[model samples]
Target: MIDHPPFALFIRGSKVDAFAVSDQLGFETGMEALAVSLFEDGPETMHVQALFETQAQAEACLDGLKFPSDMESFITQLPDEDWISKSQAGLPPVKAGRFWLYGTHDADNIPSNVPFPIEINAGLAFGTGHHGTTKGCLLIFDKLLESGFKPKRVLDLGCGAGVLAIAAAKALQQDILATDIDQDAVDVTLQNALANNVSEFVKSYQADGFDSPELKGQRFDLIFANILAKPLMGLAPDIAHALAPDGKVILSGILNEQAEMVSDAFTKKGLEVSPQPSLSGWTSLLGQKP
Candidate 1:
Protein backbone atom coordinates (compact mmCIF):
# COMPACT_ATOMS: atom_id res chain seq x y z
CA MET A 1 0.00 0.00 0.00
CA ILE A 2 1.19 3.50 -0.78
CA ASP A 3 1.76 5.86 2.10
CA HIS A 4 -0.37 8.98 2.24
CA PRO A 5 0.30 12.16 4.14
CA PRO A 6 -2.13 13.39 6.74
CA PHE A 7 -3.75 16.81 6.49
CA ALA A 8 -4.26 19.20 9.36
CA LEU A 9 -6.79 21.98 9.59
CA PHE A 10 -5.88 24.59 12.16
CA ILE A 11 -7.91 27.23 13.95
CA ARG A 12 -6.35 29.90 16.15
CA GLY A 13 -8.36 32.11 18.50
CA SER A 14 -9.20 32.75 22.13
CA LYS A 15 -9.36 29.68 24.37
CA VAL A 16 -13.14 29.64 24.54
CA ASP A 17 -13.59 30.11 20.82
CA ALA A 18 -10.95 27.48 20.07
CA PHE A 19 -12.68 24.94 22.26
CA ALA A 20 -16.00 25.73 20.62
CA VAL A 21 -14.49 25.18 17.21
CA SER A 22 -12.91 21.95 18.33
CA ASP A 23 -16.22 20.65 19.55
CA GLN A 24 -17.93 21.75 16.38
CA LEU A 25 -15.38 20.01 14.17
CA GLY A 26 -15.55 16.87 16.25
CA PHE A 27 -19.34 16.71 16.02
CA GLU A 28 -19.87 17.96 12.50
CA THR A 29 -16.91 17.02 10.36
CA GLY A 30 -16.20 13.52 11.63
CA MET A 31 -12.49 14.22 11.51
CA GLU A 32 -10.05 11.44 12.34
CA ALA A 33 -8.59 13.31 15.32
CA LEU A 34 -8.72 16.74 16.96
CA ALA A 35 -6.53 18.51 19.46
CA VAL A 36 -6.48 21.82 21.28
CA SER A 37 -3.29 23.43 22.52
CA LEU A 38 -2.13 26.76 23.86
CA PHE A 39 -0.53 28.81 21.12
CA GLU A 40 3.22 29.35 21.40
CA ASP A 41 2.88 33.12 21.41
CA GLY A 42 1.01 33.26 24.73
CA PRO A 43 -1.21 31.32 27.10
CA GLU A 44 -4.24 33.40 26.21
CA THR A 45 -4.15 32.23 22.60
CA MET A 46 -5.49 28.76 21.78
CA HIS A 47 -4.95 26.56 18.73
CA VAL A 48 -7.24 23.82 17.45
CA GLN A 49 -5.80 21.23 15.09
CA ALA A 50 -8.04 18.77 13.26
CA LEU A 51 -6.41 15.88 11.44
CA PHE A 52 -7.82 14.23 8.36
CA GLU A 53 -6.74 11.31 6.17
CA THR A 54 -7.00 13.34 3.00
CA GLN A 55 -6.32 16.90 1.95
CA ALA A 56 -9.71 17.14 0.26
CA GLN A 57 -11.45 16.09 3.43
CA ALA A 58 -9.54 18.68 5.46
CA GLU A 59 -10.29 21.44 2.96
CA ALA A 60 -13.94 20.44 2.73
CA CYS A 61 -14.31 20.33 6.48
CA LEU A 62 -12.67 23.71 6.78
CA ASP A 63 -14.93 25.16 4.09
CA GLY A 64 -18.04 23.88 5.82
CA LEU A 65 -17.27 25.60 9.09
CA LYS A 66 -18.40 29.19 9.74
CA PHE A 67 -15.65 30.45 11.99
CA PRO A 68 -15.83 33.65 14.02
CA SER A 69 -14.50 36.80 12.38
CA ASP A 70 -11.60 37.08 14.76
CA MET A 71 -10.52 33.46 14.46
CA GLU A 72 -7.92 32.34 11.89
CA SER A 73 -8.24 29.05 10.00
CA PHE A 74 -6.11 27.18 7.45
CA ILE A 75 -5.14 23.75 6.20
CA THR A 76 -1.75 22.14 5.59
CA GLN A 77 -0.60 18.74 4.46
CA LEU A 78 1.87 17.16 6.83
CA PRO A 79 4.94 15.36 5.50
CA ASP A 80 4.67 11.65 4.94
CA GLU A 81 6.59 10.49 7.96
CA ASP A 82 6.27 8.56 11.22
CA TRP A 83 4.66 11.56 12.86
CA ILE A 84 3.58 9.68 15.97
CA SER A 85 7.10 8.58 16.77
CA LYS A 86 8.58 11.97 15.86
CA SER A 87 6.06 13.80 18.04
CA GLN A 88 6.51 11.42 20.99
CA ALA A 89 10.32 11.27 20.75
CA GLY A 90 10.79 14.46 22.75
CA LEU A 91 8.34 13.56 25.55
CA PRO A 92 10.23 12.87 28.76
CA PRO A 93 8.94 10.33 31.24
CA VAL A 94 6.07 11.84 33.22
CA LYS A 95 5.90 11.13 36.95
CA ALA A 96 2.31 11.61 38.09
CA GLY A 97 2.06 11.02 41.81
CA ARG A 98 3.39 7.47 42.31
CA PHE A 99 2.67 6.28 38.78
CA TRP A 100 5.63 6.42 36.42
CA LEU A 101 4.60 6.80 32.72
CA TYR A 102 7.34 6.45 30.19
CA GLY A 103 7.72 5.77 26.51
CA THR A 104 10.06 3.00 25.41
CA HIS A 105 12.97 5.44 25.17
CA ASP A 106 12.88 5.99 28.94
CA ALA A 107 12.30 2.37 29.86
CA ASP A 108 15.85 1.88 31.21
CA ASN A 109 15.72 4.92 33.49
CA ILE A 110 12.64 3.97 35.58
CA PRO A 111 13.30 4.75 39.22
CA SER A 112 13.37 1.90 41.72
CA ASN A 113 10.85 3.45 44.12
CA VAL A 114 8.07 3.78 41.57
CA PRO A 115 5.57 1.00 42.18
CA PHE A 116 3.60 1.33 38.98
CA PRO A 117 5.80 1.78 35.94
CA ILE A 118 3.63 2.00 32.81
CA GLU A 119 5.31 1.92 29.40
CA ILE A 120 3.21 3.76 26.83
CA ASN A 121 4.26 5.13 23.46
CA ALA A 122 2.28 7.69 21.54
CA GLY A 123 0.28 6.12 18.72
CA LEU A 124 -2.87 6.59 16.71
CA ALA A 125 -4.89 6.72 19.93
CA PHE A 126 -4.73 9.33 22.67
CA GLY A 127 -3.50 9.33 26.32
CA THR A 128 0.24 8.79 26.32
CA GLY A 129 0.16 10.54 29.74
CA HIS A 130 1.54 13.80 28.36
CA HIS A 131 -1.76 15.60 27.90
CA GLY A 132 -2.91 17.58 30.92
CA THR A 133 -6.25 15.78 31.13
CA THR A 134 -4.72 12.30 31.18
CA LYS A 135 -1.98 13.35 33.60
CA GLY A 136 -4.56 14.97 35.87
CA CYS A 137 -6.61 11.79 35.98
CA LEU A 138 -3.51 9.77 36.84
CA LEU A 139 -2.60 12.18 39.62
CA ILE A 140 -6.06 12.11 41.13
CA PHE A 141 -6.27 8.33 40.87
CA ASP A 142 -2.84 7.98 42.42
CA LYS A 143 -3.89 10.09 45.41
CA LEU A 144 -7.03 8.00 45.79
CA LEU A 145 -4.94 4.83 45.83
CA GLU A 146 -2.63 6.38 48.40
CA SER A 147 -5.63 7.17 50.62
CA GLY A 148 -6.40 3.43 50.92
CA PHE A 149 -9.31 3.57 48.50
CA LYS A 150 -9.39 0.02 47.24
CA PRO A 151 -11.89 -0.45 44.45
CA LYS A 152 -12.78 -3.93 43.37
CA ARG A 153 -14.55 -3.11 40.14
CA VAL A 154 -12.83 -0.53 37.96
CA LEU A 155 -13.85 0.95 34.61
CA ASP A 156 -11.93 3.23 32.27
CA LEU A 157 -14.52 4.90 30.08
CA GLY A 158 -13.20 6.33 26.85
CA CYS A 159 -10.06 4.42 27.60
CA GLY A 160 -8.08 5.99 24.74
CA ALA A 161 -4.71 4.28 24.83
CA GLY A 162 -5.73 2.54 28.08
CA VAL A 163 -3.22 4.41 30.23
CA LEU A 164 -5.64 4.75 33.16
CA ALA A 165 -6.77 1.14 32.86
CA ILE A 166 -3.20 -0.08 32.74
CA ALA A 167 -2.28 2.01 35.76
CA ALA A 168 -5.19 0.69 37.79
CA ALA A 169 -4.36 -2.86 36.79
CA LYS A 170 -0.71 -2.44 37.76
CA ALA A 171 -1.50 -0.90 41.14
CA LEU A 172 -4.62 -2.84 42.13
CA GLN A 173 -3.90 -6.19 40.36
CA GLN A 174 -7.61 -6.24 39.54
CA ASP A 175 -9.54 -6.56 36.32
CA ILE A 176 -10.15 -3.23 34.57
CA LEU A 177 -12.85 -2.84 31.93
CA ALA A 178 -11.64 -0.41 29.26
CA THR A 179 -14.01 0.93 26.62
CA ASP A 180 -13.79 3.53 23.89
CA ILE A 181 -15.92 4.77 20.99
CA ASP A 182 -13.29 3.94 18.38
CA GLN A 183 -12.28 0.40 17.52
CA ASP A 184 -8.74 1.51 16.74
CA ALA A 185 -8.48 2.85 20.25
CA VAL A 186 -9.80 -0.40 21.66
CA ASP A 187 -7.17 -2.32 19.71
CA VAL A 188 -4.46 0.08 20.82
CA THR A 189 -5.57 -0.18 24.43
CA LEU A 190 -5.42 -3.94 24.37
CA GLN A 191 -1.99 -3.82 22.74
CA ASN A 192 -0.76 -1.39 25.34
CA ALA A 193 -2.17 -3.54 28.11
CA LEU A 194 -0.24 -6.48 26.75
CA ALA A 195 2.89 -4.38 26.41
CA ASN A 196 2.53 -3.30 30.04
CA ASN A 197 2.10 -6.99 31.03
CA VAL A 198 -1.38 -6.27 32.34
CA SER A 199 -3.33 -7.94 29.56
CA GLU A 200 -4.64 -10.49 32.02
CA PHE A 201 -6.09 -7.73 34.17
CA VAL A 202 -7.29 -5.35 31.46
CA LYS A 203 -10.30 -6.08 29.22
CA SER A 204 -10.98 -3.72 26.34
CA TYR A 205 -14.11 -3.14 24.24
CA GLN A 206 -15.33 -0.76 21.57
CA ALA A 207 -18.42 0.92 22.93
CA ASP A 208 -20.12 4.20 22.39
CA GLY A 209 -20.58 5.65 25.84
CA PHE A 210 -22.44 3.06 27.96
CA ASP A 211 -24.08 1.14 25.13
CA SER A 212 -21.80 -1.88 24.95
CA PRO A 213 -22.86 -5.29 26.22
CA GLU A 214 -19.80 -5.34 28.44
CA LEU A 215 -21.17 -2.43 30.45
CA LYS A 216 -24.78 -3.53 30.66
CA GLY A 217 -26.14 -3.73 34.21
CA GLN A 218 -22.61 -3.17 35.55
CA ARG A 219 -21.71 -1.02 38.53
CA PHE A 220 -18.13 0.05 39.01
CA ASP A 221 -16.47 0.99 42.28
CA LEU A 222 -14.12 3.32 40.43
CA ILE A 223 -14.59 4.91 37.00
CA PHE A 224 -12.43 7.18 34.86
CA ALA A 225 -13.81 9.30 32.03
CA ASN A 226 -11.29 11.63 30.40
CA ILE A 227 -13.48 12.76 27.54
CA LEU A 228 -14.53 16.18 26.31
CA ALA A 229 -16.58 18.34 28.65
CA LYS A 230 -19.75 18.39 26.53
CA PRO A 231 -19.92 14.61 26.23
CA LEU A 232 -19.01 14.26 29.88
CA MET A 233 -22.00 16.45 30.82
CA GLY A 234 -24.34 14.57 28.53
CA LEU A 235 -23.29 11.22 30.01
CA ALA A 236 -23.81 12.35 33.59
CA PRO A 237 -26.95 10.32 34.23
CA ASP A 238 -25.56 7.16 32.67
CA ILE A 239 -22.30 7.53 34.54
CA ALA A 240 -24.08 8.15 37.81
CA HIS A 241 -26.26 5.13 37.25
CA ALA A 242 -23.28 2.93 36.52
CA LEU A 243 -21.52 3.82 39.77
CA ALA A 244 -21.94 1.61 42.81
CA PRO A 245 -22.87 3.18 46.12
CA ASP A 246 -20.09 5.48 47.29
CA GLY A 247 -18.28 4.90 44.02
CA LYS A 248 -15.82 7.48 42.72
CA VAL A 249 -15.51 9.00 39.24
CA ILE A 250 -12.55 10.92 37.79
CA LEU A 251 -13.53 13.31 34.98
CA SER A 252 -11.25 15.40 32.79
CA GLY A 253 -10.99 16.91 29.24
CA ILE A 254 -12.65 20.06 30.50
CA LEU A 255 -11.50 23.65 30.25
CA ASN A 256 -10.93 25.60 33.46
CA GLU A 257 -13.84 27.91 32.76
CA GLN A 258 -16.22 25.04 31.99
CA ALA A 259 -15.45 23.05 35.12
CA GLU A 260 -18.40 24.33 37.11
CA MET A 261 -20.84 23.53 34.32
CA VAL A 262 -19.66 19.91 34.16
CA SER A 263 -19.67 19.59 37.93
CA ASP A 264 -23.25 20.88 38.11
CA ALA A 265 -24.33 18.30 35.57
CA PHE A 266 -23.00 15.49 37.68
CA THR A 267 -24.32 17.11 40.85
CA LYS A 268 -27.81 17.15 39.37
CA LYS A 269 -27.46 13.40 38.98
CA GLY A 270 -26.90 13.18 42.77
CA LEU A 271 -23.12 12.92 42.71
CA GLU A 272 -21.09 14.93 45.21
CA VAL A 273 -18.60 16.69 42.98
CA SER A 274 -15.33 18.50 43.66
CA PRO A 275 -12.70 19.99 41.37
CA GLN A 276 -9.10 18.79 41.32
CA PRO A 277 -6.26 21.24 40.80
CA SER A 278 -6.40 22.70 37.31
CA LEU A 279 -3.52 21.62 35.05
CA SER A 280 -2.37 23.48 31.96
CA GLY A 281 -5.63 25.39 31.58
CA TRP A 282 -7.61 22.13 31.88
CA THR A 283 -9.76 20.95 34.79
CA SER A 284 -10.43 17.54 36.27
CA LEU A 285 -13.43 16.79 38.49
CA LEU A 286 -13.85 14.09 41.07
CA GLY A 287 -17.32 12.86 41.94
CA GLN A 288 -18.70 10.39 44.44
CA LYS A 289 -22.02 8.65 44.22
CA PRO A 290 -23.55 8.94 47.63
Candidate 2:
Protein backbone atom coordinates (compact mmCIF):
# COMPACT_ATOMS: atom_id res chain seq x y z
CA MET A 1 0.00 0.00 0.00
CA ILE A 2 1.10 3.54 -0.71
CA ASP A 3 2.06 5.57 2.37
CA HIS A 4 -1.04 7.69 2.40
CA PRO A 5 -1.39 10.14 5.29
CA PRO A 6 -4.83 8.92 6.30
CA PHE A 7 -5.61 5.63 4.59
CA ALA A 8 -8.85 3.70 4.98
CA LEU A 9 -9.98 0.26 3.84
CA PHE A 10 -13.49 -1.14 3.48
CA ILE A 11 -14.37 -4.80 3.73
CA ARG A 12 -17.77 -6.36 3.26
CA GLY A 13 -18.62 -9.98 3.87
CA SER A 14 -20.53 -12.32 6.18
CA LYS A 15 -20.95 -9.85 9.01
CA VAL A 16 -20.51 -12.20 11.97
CA ASP A 17 -17.56 -14.08 10.50
CA ALA A 18 -16.02 -10.86 9.34
CA PHE A 19 -16.22 -9.34 12.82
CA ALA A 20 -14.72 -12.44 14.34
CA VAL A 21 -11.94 -12.33 11.81
CA SER A 22 -11.34 -8.65 12.37
CA ASP A 23 -11.20 -9.00 16.16
CA GLN A 24 -8.92 -12.01 16.03
CA LEU A 25 -6.59 -10.18 13.71
CA GLY A 26 -6.64 -7.04 15.87
CA PHE A 27 -6.01 -8.66 19.27
CA GLU A 28 -3.51 -11.17 17.97
CA THR A 29 -1.50 -8.90 15.71
CA GLY A 30 -2.46 -5.37 16.86
CA MET A 31 -3.48 -4.49 13.30
CA GLU A 32 -5.16 -1.22 12.50
CA ALA A 33 -8.71 -2.42 11.81
CA LEU A 34 -12.23 -1.43 12.74
CA ALA A 35 -15.13 -3.79 12.10
CA VAL A 36 -18.57 -2.43 11.48
CA SER A 37 -21.38 -4.98 11.40
CA LEU A 38 -24.74 -3.80 10.23
CA PHE A 39 -27.89 -4.88 8.42
CA GLU A 40 -28.80 -2.92 5.37
CA ASP A 41 -32.07 -1.01 4.97
CA GLY A 42 -33.62 -4.46 4.81
CA PRO A 43 -32.44 -7.61 6.61
CA GLU A 44 -31.93 -9.78 3.54
CA THR A 45 -28.17 -9.88 4.06
CA MET A 46 -25.77 -8.77 6.77
CA HIS A 47 -22.90 -6.40 6.06
CA VAL A 48 -19.43 -5.83 7.52
CA GLN A 49 -16.96 -3.00 6.89
CA ALA A 50 -13.47 -3.32 8.27
CA LEU A 51 -11.50 -0.09 7.95
CA PHE A 52 -7.74 -0.26 7.74
CA GLU A 53 -4.78 2.08 7.33
CA THR A 54 -3.48 0.60 4.07
CA GLN A 55 -4.92 -1.55 1.28
CA ALA A 56 -1.87 -3.80 1.16
CA GLN A 57 -1.75 -4.18 4.95
CA ALA A 58 -5.43 -5.05 5.04
CA GLU A 59 -5.01 -7.46 2.14
CA ALA A 60 -1.96 -9.12 3.65
CA CYS A 61 -3.70 -9.54 7.02
CA LEU A 62 -6.85 -10.87 5.42
CA ASP A 63 -4.84 -13.32 3.34
CA GLY A 64 -3.66 -15.01 6.52
CA LEU A 65 -7.07 -14.88 8.25
CA LYS A 66 -8.60 -18.33 8.71
CA PHE A 67 -12.21 -18.11 7.60
CA PRO A 68 -14.67 -20.92 7.10
CA SER A 69 -14.52 -22.43 3.59
CA ASP A 70 -17.80 -20.69 2.68
CA MET A 71 -16.95 -17.32 4.21
CA GLU A 72 -16.41 -14.56 1.66
CA SER A 73 -15.06 -11.00 1.57
CA PHE A 74 -14.46 -8.03 -0.73
CA ILE A 75 -11.86 -5.36 -0.05
CA THR A 76 -11.19 -1.92 -1.48
CA GLN A 77 -9.64 1.39 -0.55
CA LEU A 78 -12.05 4.23 0.07
CA PRO A 79 -11.71 7.09 -2.37
CA ASP A 80 -9.65 9.89 -0.89
CA GLU A 81 -12.29 12.54 -1.47
CA ASP A 82 -15.01 10.45 0.14
CA TRP A 83 -12.83 9.49 3.07
CA ILE A 84 -11.74 13.07 3.73
CA SER A 85 -15.25 14.46 3.47
CA LYS A 86 -16.72 11.81 5.73
CA SER A 87 -13.97 12.12 8.31
CA GLN A 88 -14.41 15.87 8.40
CA ALA A 89 -18.05 15.41 9.29
CA GLY A 90 -19.33 15.90 12.83
CA LEU A 91 -18.49 13.38 15.52
CA PRO A 92 -20.92 12.23 18.13
CA PRO A 93 -20.73 14.19 21.38
CA VAL A 94 -19.24 12.54 24.50
CA LYS A 95 -20.22 13.58 28.01
CA ALA A 96 -18.86 12.83 31.48
CA GLY A 97 -19.40 15.04 34.47
CA ARG A 98 -20.36 18.53 33.22
CA PHE A 99 -17.82 18.27 30.38
CA TRP A 100 -18.84 17.77 26.78
CA LEU A 101 -16.33 16.42 24.23
CA TYR A 102 -16.81 17.40 20.61
CA GLY A 103 -14.82 16.93 17.46
CA THR A 104 -13.39 19.92 15.60
CA HIS A 105 -16.54 20.31 13.53
CA ASP A 106 -18.82 20.39 16.57
CA ALA A 107 -16.61 22.42 18.91
CA ASP A 108 -17.44 25.67 17.18
CA ASN A 109 -21.13 25.08 17.83
CA ILE A 110 -20.82 24.41 21.55
CA PRO A 111 -22.58 26.93 23.78
CA SER A 112 -20.32 29.25 25.78
CA ASN A 113 -22.07 28.72 29.10
CA VAL A 114 -21.26 25.05 29.24
CA PRO A 115 -18.95 23.99 32.10
CA PHE A 116 -16.39 22.53 29.68
CA PRO A 117 -16.19 21.75 25.99
CA ILE A 118 -13.22 20.06 24.35
CA GLU A 119 -12.49 19.35 20.71
CA ILE A 120 -11.04 15.83 20.68
CA ASN A 121 -10.30 15.21 17.02
CA ALA A 122 -8.31 11.98 17.07
CA GLY A 123 -7.45 12.11 13.38
CA LEU A 124 -5.99 8.66 12.66
CA ALA A 125 -5.44 7.94 16.37
CA PHE A 126 -6.68 4.57 17.59
CA GLY A 127 -9.20 5.98 20.05
CA THR A 128 -12.19 8.06 18.93
CA GLY A 129 -14.03 8.18 22.32
CA HIS A 130 -16.68 5.69 21.14
CA HIS A 131 -15.26 2.43 22.42
CA GLY A 132 -17.01 0.57 25.25
CA THR A 133 -13.78 0.34 27.24
CA THR A 134 -13.55 4.12 27.41
CA LYS A 135 -17.24 4.67 28.16
CA GLY A 136 -17.12 2.12 30.98
CA CYS A 137 -14.22 3.92 32.69
CA LEU A 138 -16.13 7.20 32.44
CA LEU A 139 -19.17 5.62 34.05
CA ILE A 140 -17.15 4.23 36.93
CA PHE A 141 -15.41 7.54 37.36
CA ASP A 142 -18.81 9.21 37.54
CA LYS A 143 -19.89 6.85 40.26
CA LEU A 144 -16.75 7.69 42.20
CA LEU A 145 -17.51 11.37 41.91
CA GLU A 146 -21.14 10.94 42.84
CA SER A 147 -19.98 9.37 46.07
CA GLY A 148 -17.77 12.40 46.78
CA PHE A 149 -14.46 10.60 46.36
CA LYS A 150 -11.59 12.90 45.36
CA PRO A 151 -7.93 12.40 44.49
CA LYS A 152 -5.30 15.11 44.42
CA ARG A 153 -3.02 14.05 41.57
CA VAL A 154 -3.98 12.03 38.51
CA LEU A 155 -2.25 10.13 35.69
CA ASP A 156 -3.65 8.66 32.50
CA LEU A 157 -1.52 5.94 30.95
CA GLY A 158 -2.04 5.02 27.33
CA CYS A 159 -3.96 8.26 27.29
CA GLY A 160 -5.03 8.08 23.63
CA ALA A 161 -7.06 11.23 23.09
CA GLY A 162 -6.49 12.05 26.78
CA VAL A 163 -10.17 11.72 27.58
CA LEU A 164 -9.43 10.20 30.99
CA ALA A 165 -6.96 12.93 31.86
CA ILE A 166 -9.41 15.58 30.72
CA ALA A 167 -12.06 13.99 32.89
CA ALA A 168 -9.77 13.90 35.90
CA ALA A 169 -8.61 17.48 35.48
CA LYS A 170 -12.19 18.67 35.24
CA ALA A 171 -13.15 16.76 38.33
CA LEU A 172 -10.19 17.43 40.62
CA GLN A 173 -8.83 20.63 39.12
CA GLN A 174 -5.44 19.09 39.82
CA ASP A 175 -2.32 18.52 37.78
CA ILE A 176 -2.96 15.68 35.34
CA LEU A 177 -0.29 13.86 33.36
CA ALA A 178 -1.58 12.11 30.26
CA THR A 179 0.85 9.98 28.29
CA ASP A 180 0.64 7.78 25.22
CA ILE A 181 3.13 5.80 23.16
CA ASP A 182 2.23 7.44 19.87
CA GLN A 183 3.32 11.00 19.21
CA ASP A 184 0.13 11.53 17.20
CA ALA A 185 -1.85 10.63 20.29
CA VAL A 186 0.19 13.08 22.36
CA ASP A 187 -0.57 15.84 19.86
CA VAL A 188 -4.25 14.95 19.83
CA THR A 189 -4.30 14.90 23.63
CA LEU A 190 -2.65 18.30 23.87
CA GLN A 191 -5.03 19.73 21.31
CA ASN A 192 -8.00 18.40 23.21
CA ALA A 193 -6.63 19.77 26.49
CA LEU A 194 -6.18 23.20 24.96
CA ALA A 195 -9.63 23.16 23.41
CA ASN A 196 -11.08 22.51 26.86
CA ASN A 197 -8.96 25.33 28.33
CA VAL A 198 -7.31 22.81 30.64
CA SER A 199 -3.93 22.97 28.95
CA GLU A 200 -2.51 24.43 32.15
CA PHE A 201 -3.99 21.73 34.32
CA VAL A 202 -3.39 18.76 32.05
CA LYS A 203 -0.06 18.01 30.34
CA SER A 204 0.52 15.58 27.51
CA TYR A 205 3.60 13.38 26.90
CA GLN A 206 4.50 10.56 24.57
CA ALA A 207 5.49 7.67 26.81
CA ASP A 208 4.90 3.92 26.86
CA GLY A 209 4.72 1.82 30.03
CA PHE A 210 7.49 3.03 32.34
CA ASP A 211 9.71 4.38 29.61
CA SER A 212 8.72 7.93 30.55
CA PRO A 213 11.75 9.26 32.40
CA GLU A 214 9.72 12.00 34.01
CA LEU A 215 7.30 9.58 35.60
CA LYS A 216 10.05 7.60 37.30
CA GLY A 217 9.70 7.48 41.12
CA GLN A 218 6.70 9.74 40.88
CA ARG A 219 3.51 9.04 42.79
CA PHE A 220 -0.08 9.98 42.22
CA ASP A 221 -3.28 9.79 44.21
CA LEU A 222 -5.05 8.23 41.25
CA ILE A 223 -4.01 6.44 38.06
CA PHE A 224 -6.10 5.39 35.10
CA ALA A 225 -4.80 2.86 32.58
CA ASN A 226 -7.05 1.86 29.73
CA ILE A 227 -4.60 -0.29 27.83
CA LEU A 228 -4.76 -3.99 26.98
CA ALA A 229 -4.00 -6.89 29.34
CA LYS A 230 -0.40 -7.57 28.34
CA PRO A 231 0.87 -4.01 28.83
CA LEU A 232 -1.27 -3.62 31.89
CA MET A 233 0.54 -6.60 33.37
CA GLY A 234 3.96 -5.35 32.31
CA LEU A 235 3.30 -1.99 33.95
CA ALA A 236 1.98 -3.46 37.17
CA PRO A 237 5.20 -2.73 38.99
CA ASP A 238 5.44 0.84 37.82
CA ILE A 239 1.76 1.42 38.48
CA ALA A 240 2.06 0.03 41.96
CA HIS A 241 5.25 1.93 42.68
CA ALA A 242 3.92 5.20 41.31
CA LEU A 243 0.71 5.01 43.35
CA ALA A 244 0.54 6.61 46.77
CA PRO A 245 -0.61 4.77 49.82
CA ASP A 246 -4.33 4.22 49.46
CA GLY A 247 -4.14 5.47 45.88
CA LYS A 248 -6.93 4.33 43.61
CA VAL A 249 -6.23 2.67 40.26
CA ILE A 250 -8.68 2.09 37.43
CA LEU A 251 -8.02 -0.27 34.52
CA SER A 252 -9.94 -1.41 31.46
CA GLY A 253 -9.58 -2.67 27.84
CA ILE A 254 -9.30 -6.32 28.79
CA LEU A 255 -11.76 -9.17 28.78
CA ASN A 256 -13.00 -10.90 31.97
CA GLU A 257 -10.66 -13.88 31.78
CA GLN A 258 -7.62 -11.76 31.17
CA ALA A 259 -8.46 -9.62 34.18
CA GLU A 260 -7.23 -12.37 36.49
CA MET A 261 -3.75 -12.33 35.06
CA VAL A 262 -3.55 -8.56 35.18
CA SER A 263 -5.05 -8.41 38.65
CA ASP A 264 -2.58 -11.01 39.87
CA ALA A 265 0.35 -9.01 38.64
CA PHE A 266 -0.82 -5.94 40.52
CA THR A 267 -1.77 -8.00 43.54
CA LYS A 268 1.70 -9.44 43.79
CA LYS A 269 2.90 -5.87 43.95
CA GLY A 270 0.62 -5.18 46.96
CA LEU A 271 -2.32 -3.71 45.12
CA GLU A 272 -5.71 -5.25 45.77
CA VAL A 273 -7.97 -5.69 42.81
CA SER A 274 -11.56 -4.92 43.44
CA PRO A 275 -14.43 -6.69 41.76
CA GLN A 276 -14.71 -6.10 38.03
CA PRO A 277 -17.63 -4.52 36.23
CA SER A 278 -18.57 -6.19 32.97
CA LEU A 279 -19.64 -4.54 29.73
CA SER A 280 -20.07 -6.34 26.42
CA GLY A 281 -17.80 -9.17 27.63
CA TRP A 282 -14.98 -6.75 28.45
CA THR A 283 -14.04 -6.07 32.08
CA SER A 284 -12.82 -3.09 34.06
CA LEU A 285 -10.77 -3.83 37.17
CA LEU A 286 -10.38 -1.37 40.02
CA GLY A 287 -7.53 -1.62 42.51
CA GLN A 288 -6.06 0.28 45.39
CA LYS A 289 -2.69 0.33 47.11
CA PRO A 290 -3.43 0.02 50.81
C-alpha TM-score for every candidate: 0.83, 0.72
Q: What is the lDDT of residue 261 in candidate 2?
A: 88
Q: Over the full model, what C-alpha lDDT does candidate 1 score relative to the true structure?
A: 0.84
**Residue pairs in candidate 1 whose N, alpha carbon or C atoms collide under 3 angstroms:** none
lDDT of 1 by residue, 6-79 (tens): 67788899776775675566444555553322232347667767667778877888877777888988889878
Report backbone clashes per prediction.
Answer: 0, 0
Residue-level lDDT tens digits of model 2 in 81-118: 54533654634777755666677777567877666565
Candidate 2 wrong stretches, greater than 4 Å = 1-7, 10-75, 79-82, 88-91, 96-99, 105-116
